[model samples]
Target: MITSTTGLYLTAFLVGLLGGVHCLSMCGGLVGSLTAGLDPRIRRDPWRMAPYQLLYNLARIAGYATAGALFGGLGALLLQLDAFQIMQRALYALAGVVMILLGLYLGGWWRLIAVVERAGAHLWRRIEPFGRRLLPVRTPLQAAALGYLWAWIPCGLVYSVLITAVSTGHPLDGALVMLAFGAGTLPNLLGIGLLAGAAARIAERVWVRQVAGLLVIGFGVHALWSLFG
Candidate 1:
């Protein structure tokens, strides 16, 4: 029944890992553009560029963790209301459904989740200008700022994971869950910044995406099944 905190962390991480194909499509272009804006010397040398990439991604993950904590707190507040058990069950069910929808979206089998992204479009527009100002990144700070701002970009994948975080019902647990998820995403995004073209090509493969999608779907199915078990 996935009782352990460790199990929850693993699920979050696997979801992030399996969802990399979607990450490639959603953030790959942005990563490529940002990397291109780096100082010529840093952009040319792998060793020099590595630090900027790390800072950028780490800041982005930090943003996710921040959001997760906030949402988790909200979930905890909700559970304090009357019928706490009912509320908890409802939240869990919602998390499972969102995960299933995310899996479908990742597989390209359904586009409904895009609607959720659209809902956040206005907020992203406001956030995007700040990111633009950070461009032509000459320092690690700029890259980090850019990454932090980009974390607010309208993304179904991020939102889906946030739902799972909210189900944790504890701010610290939620933050940790997202931290693990962000760690899972680190490799693919880092690769995109450093090896943009190759990473994009590999992620573009139809079978690779389908397989990842199915695996994620299995996680959701198990989550639902566990409720009755």
Candidate 2:
């Protein structure tokens, strides 16, 4: 049987993959723009551009992993406080509901997800300036740095996944979870950066988005049921 831990990782990756579809819908142009910012020569040569793209994503994933670790650490702290059992239950329940909201956001059903994102904007602004300094990237390090900044860009998808990270209640566990989520998002963001329109088209398929959304909802339901069961 798949360990519950492994299952969580798989789910995180799936969530990332599904989020890619959403990214294509919402951030396709942004992906394209990242490429546009690349050196013209690199942009023109596929072989040359591959490394830069990879570096950018690697950085982004690193950021996600780091964030997960922090969230997990906080969760761990929260779990140790008074009424530990109640706190754990509450945390899991919150995660379940957030997952449902994520599914809705992915399905284009509940746009309210953005409210969470807007809350993160304050943090993003603080980091945005630093990211700007690396713009028009000329080196792998620069690309990676830019990606680290990109990871902080507020999105409901990320926040929803963080809720899962929070439930892990260990820094390492949280990091691993977010790393999985980041990996899931990789295909979409990476592909659009490379294939642009073609990949975006595939991501934009309504059926694909709906299926991913339903799966997310199922995860949430399962989570809640487990709590009550």
Candidate 3:
């Protein structure tokens, strides 16, 4: 489904890896919280728990695909509308700024990023309870569904990618781009969920977070420059 040039594919992969890194901190809690109910015996069994973790991640990826498809379709509809270019560029600029703010937040420069995320609070509240109901998820399918639903939680990283996807100007392409982005995170998420303590320790390091923030901010700046230059 991904047919981009080597460079674009590599870029998508790198972005996915970065997204995974961001999730290392934010998503670890969710994964831990979800897996907390497992029997000590089950938790100790890597073979059984591993499948659940993989399924949970796949579900989340599916969610990204769904979002990508929806946004891509929206972009397509917008393309047919009058003044779509102007609207698209406006969205590009806005998304870029949001990414910059997200980077700053990641860098520990501000705490207000939560406020931007809270804009989706109402929807999240509605969906979150449903996710909780799937708690102590035993089956891979259940874990996947929960993960998919959880993917919609307000995340600046995902939003940044969404903005990039929409700017591609084709709904199918947008969806594929997001899928590529999601694929990029597989390694990190898979590893972190399985090795919680180590992942958390690595993510908590100041230098690691700062480097990630800088990379995201650099991307945001580049996006802005591309739009206005």
Candidate 4:
């Protein structure tokens, strides 16, 4: 079970890493706005901008971990109910299916996940004002706040991973899963000079997304096979 859990963590990380293209597509404007808000002196100097970038991303990941814990606890509660106990395996199965759908979505083969994102839009509308207030960020704290707010944005990719987090049925495990995933995404969102540009270019290619989608699909298949094989 330990090994299996660890494998799930790895898969989560890869999903985040490989999902960079999607992230770029979804949040590219936000990332641009983040940098744009920085003082010109800091923006021009990589050293100065580093701390702001790091803090915001870290805070964003923290938001994900917090959400994971909430969903994980919800799963735990459902399992605790006598009538709902049987739903545990069903949740896992659903998670696997969601991953497969996420792969298809990432590969541009399907877009059903957009409906899930749209469902969250109303909540985002409420939270967006807080993020806007933090804009033109001068302090790391303000940037962090903005990043945390950004985490709640309607994102199908994030919701897909949250499905897997719910299947974990443990708060710590779910938080860990999201932490690993967030770490994997750190490289792309870090917005470093040349590397960020190169990553963006690479992620834009059709083949990269297809390859990533296939690998994610394989993970989902493996998960389902383990459950029923």
Candidate 5:
């Protein structure tokens, strides 16, 4: 039998990979900006760039954990309400809609995702300053902290995962689910953060994000169907 811990680890790894692919578009630019001007020789040295990338991802993962904790707490309380099941189904439905919208946005069918992006603007504003302070980060710890903090930026993807957590019923379980989601994103992100130019070329293709969006939407639909059917 798969223990909860095993499940969490598996979920985290899968989600990290998928999330890494999904984040290619958003993260590519940031990684480039972070590592723009090093010497060609240094840039080519995986030894140097690897640590920076690792730190960046570590920070983002930390952010996901923090958000999971907060949301998990809320989910726990909400579970006490008599209408919890109804609310969960509603959240699942909303997540499906958001995933579809994200798919459209990824496919260039819609550009109005600014509305969703704006929702996290306030949090971003607060965190942006801290990221700036970590500029030219030379250590793994620094990269991790910055990435952890950066993860809180409001995102439709994160929002989708949040809803998934809430629906899990147990607050701790919900949090772990999101953590799994974050872990799923790591492989791609670690690659992109370390090798921005190459990763960007691949990720920037219109078809990739569209397909990822579709997969996410499918997950959302599956959740909803399982709930209501």
Candidate 6:
């Protein structure tokens, strides 16, 4: 159960750390495209490419934390209304339920999470063209701007952890939770952007994703138990 601020942050981080393995396939193409957009000079030199990649991903993480803050604030605001105390509990429970389903989605045992993903796909489609406008990035700031837009890109993993963030009912705590989650993903996504071929192979392996998926499932179970246990 994510009863404490630190526990929530850790849970969010674990979700991103373990679940990010799946994003290799989902976001690898985007990472590739982002890299490919860079000048050939940067592509040829690993040192030059590092800063741009880091900036882009950091901006993306900022977007995640921003969303978490907004949603958490909204949740907090809602709680100010009468009879909303129970609603807060419902939100937390819903977070746990969605998390379990997301794990199943990650594990390839179910596709229920796609419903959530699809719900936002339209909004993502609208936001995606903005990223295209920044292609062939000339500066780290430009890449970072593109990343900020891409943060809203639809993905079950992001959405799963975001739901948990919202349930925190505090803007700062929610932002912190998402920040930790984003940090967890930093390693994997940065690795994928740097080593697409190797990351692809690892992502393609069935057992690798399954193991990571199971851990995510366990997190969901733990979250639920924390609520009721």
Q: All predictions: root-mean-square deviation over Cα? A: 1.3, 2.2, 2.9, 2.1, 3.4, 1.3
- Candidate 4 lDDT over residue span 117-206, tens digit each: 899999999999999898888899998898888888887778767877776778988888888888877887885321446656777789
Q: Please, what are the lDDT tens digits per residue for candidate 5 over residues 1-229?
A: 1224455446345544544555777766667655654456667888877767776776687678778777777877888999987776786677666766665666667756558878889878988888778776556676676687678776777776676566666767766777787777777777775765687677778787667656655555654565566
Off by over 4 Å in 6: none
- Winner by lDDT: 1
Cα lDDT tens digits for candidate 6, 106-197: 78889888899899999998998888889878888898998899889888888877777777778987788889989998888899777757
On residues 56-147, what C-alpha lDDT tens digit does candidate 1 reach at each position?
Answer: 99999998899889988987887787886676666667767777888898787998888988988999998888888887888899888888
**C-alpha TM-scores of all predictions:** 0.95, 0.91, 0.89, 0.91, 0.84, 0.95
- Please give, for residues 195-215, the per-residue lDDT of candidate 2 as tens digits: 757887776777888887888
- Model 2 lDDT, residue 106, Cα: 78
Model 2 bad stretches (over 4 Å): 1-3
- lDDT by candidate, in order shown: 0.84, 0.80, 0.75, 0.78, 0.68, 0.83
Q: List the residue pairs that clash in candidate 2.
A: 16-184, 16-185, 17-184
Rank by lDDT (best first): 1, 6, 2, 4, 3, 5
Clashing pairs in 1: none
Candidate 1 weakest ten by summed lDDT = 84-93
Count of backbone collisions in candidate 3: 0
- Runs in model 1 lying further than 4 Å from the true structure: none
lDDT of 5 at 33: 56
